[model samples]
Target: MDLLPLEVAKKVRRDSTLVKYTDGQFIQSRGDSKPGISIVRSGAANAGIIGMDGSVSMTTLLGPGQSFGEFTIFTELPRTHDVTAVGETEIYQMTATRFTRLYDNEPQLSRALLKTALMRSHILLEMLDAIRRLPIRERAARILQSMSHTAGNPNKLECRQSELAYTLGVSRISLNRGLKQLAELKLIELGYGEIRIPRPALLSDWVANHCNPAPLAS
Candidate 1:
């Protein structure tokens, strides 16, 4: 992450609270956030909405510097997504009252939150567009490419393929098949609970080849 001015960072830091989460623990559940936003300081989290049928559809992973609960604070509504720690995770929490004070006194901090929300929206929209236009294989490739950036190690991403499948809204079988194909191509190395892209350039080429515009044939 790029450096922010000390004052701006300090303001967010002042209201921040820390919490350590164990595996399978909920950092923030759907309908849980009364107010305020939380940031991931360390470790990782899964963010998704729970379906009426009792299904949990993971939308994405939240890593360091990413914040959530903005919707609840902005709209004064219940939390929309359930955030859970995948492993032992640490987070910086802040209350809405505290956030309000900062926003009231410091317009810069307020604009920062707005900017963050807009960035998240753009990422969500891009994911939706890619999934809509491309096959699951290409989508999976792109997902892995994304993970590689956030992933702590190139050899092992903490998320399992099953969990990744849920996040991508693809069947486990399909994801497994795609992973196998990718492994066979030597583009990535797959594991029981992790993934590694040995050659990101190869995966990028795959996405470009599969998704780029092409001429119509007679």
Candidate 2:
């Protein structure tokens, strides 16, 4: 679905249920068939899968105005992943029944939402490909880049090293090493429990250079 710009908060605030979630709260759990469409008014969250062995494979970050749960809404299927609030978040939710009515009664709206969903699917596929081909450091940089919008301090990320280690499915030592490598390159700044990217463009450039150099065309 097309995300409403932050300016349209007034439009959504009236009809949608206003809900708040604290950092690390589960907004939706896997296997729940009742996921309603959520329109993010502010803050950020993440959607990811948890492996049987307890490893996490992050799918994507959802920021302000972005959305999650569209697939479940359209298919009536169990959710494939868990959505967790990355920070203090506020969202407006449209229940399954209301969304279903909109889908059935408004063909144009349905088509528009479907188009957005398809585009998101394509982006997720590309990200999965990147995760498969990229090194740990590149993956780390990508995550930091995604978090830039929600981070209170644009340069410093407000996430615990241990939690990130678990989410990335790497040993704390390994994650630290990856962070150290980026820090050494001056792409990121390391703090006690936070990581900083003084220049986000440089960080994005680091990932692009490491993982996706431009191809030469004849």
Candidate 3:
């Protein structure tokens, strides 16, 4: 979902607590039922399901301008997925009590939350359709893109092969082949527990041409 507007973001900064997390730290776990939300102010985090088979199926990669724990806050339910930092990260936490206060004080906050929730819902449908239809290579590429941030030089993705394979619901062997191809195509560089995307746009262009049903009007 989109972030709060600049003025709104600045105002909420006072009501929230900024917390740091090291890579692999859990920001939200299945054990916690606390009503709170975490906005990624700096780095990114992964939110996913741990399957009964001990595999992880990634549901979301929340980067800067994104959030987690909204479902838990509204429903007052136990966290349904695991949220782990992608790297050293900072998040702004809003507790249910604090948010309720904000909702009562600033009506705009509720509007922002409602807008973000609606947008996320629509995006989820589009994502499911794309994931089901795209080739495995395209799917992996998409996930890699999300983790990259895409601000300036592409960053190295800090994830192991097994983890990537598990989250993507593909065999390690298949994932390896995709990584190898990405490397050969100069789209990414594979390292131990990392994949670096040097030219992020190359990956985007490949997906657009290979996976996109309609050609871009350029």
Candidate 4:
């Protein structure tokens, strides 16, 4: 989902507590009973699972303006994934009680929350479809494009190759090969721990032409 509107975010910040976390600190853990929404005010957070073998499989990277923990509040369930700070991070946290109060009295807050939930659902469906139907190369391109769009930074993705491989459910070797192909195509420029798309539109157009289906016969 996109960032909340400035005024709405300001309202949320006004009612929320600002908390800081160092790198690798857990903001919320799986199965935790806390019911609160945490929005990244600075730095980033990673939501994912730690396997029994202690391997981390990151599912989502949440940057500034992105919020988490809403599902737990709505469903009255435990936190589903472990959310950890990526670096020195600041978060604005609002408890379920406070959020409910604001939600009841504020139309804009309700609309923003609903919009985030809907957008998240839509993105989840798209990710599932891409994983099922697209090749690794195309899948990588789409994901990079999505991240760039979300962050409004067409040139850089602050993500590692290993993280991308885990997200794609592919081996590091396979992901490397796919990335190499993209680099050869000059669609992306790879760096130490990031991927850069100099022209995100070109990558988007390329994915559309290759991955989109042709029109059916009349």
Q: How does each model score on lDDT?
A: 0.74, 0.70, 0.74, 0.81
The RMSD (Cα, Å) of candidate 1 is 3.3
Per-residue C-alpha lDDT of model 2 across residues 1-218, encoded as one tens digit per residue: 23334434344455469799998898888898885888666777667776688666666566666666777766778888887887788878878776666556546655556666786666555456555776788767766765564343467665667667676567889888989999999999988756778888888777767767469998
Q: Top TM-score: which candidate number? A: 4
Q: What is the Cα-based TM-score of model 4?
A: 0.89
Worst 10 residues of 3 by lDDT: 146-155
Number of residue pairs clashing in candidate 4, backbone atoms closer than 3 angstroms, sequence gap of 3 or more or interchain: 0
Model 3 residue 102 CA deviation in Å: 1.8
Better of 3 and 4 by lDDT: 4
Every candidate's CA RMSD: 3.3, 3.8, 3.8, 2.2
lDDT of 4 by residue, 1-218 (tens): 24456776677888999999998899999999989999888888878887787767766677788888988778999988988887788999999998988778778776777887797787677667777888898888877766665442458776778877888899999989999999999999999977889888899898788766678999
How high is each candidate's TM-score? 0.82, 0.74, 0.79, 0.89
Residue 186 in candidate 2 has what lDDT? 96
Per-model tally of clashing residue pairs: 0, 0, 0, 0
Off by over 4 Å in 4: 1-7, 151-154
Find the 10 residues in a row with the least total lDDT in model 1: 147-156
In candidate 4 the C-alpha lDDT for residue 125 amounts to 71
Candidate 3 or 4, higher TM-score? Answer: 4
Task: List the candidate numbers ranked by lDDT, top first.
Answer: 4, 1, 3, 2
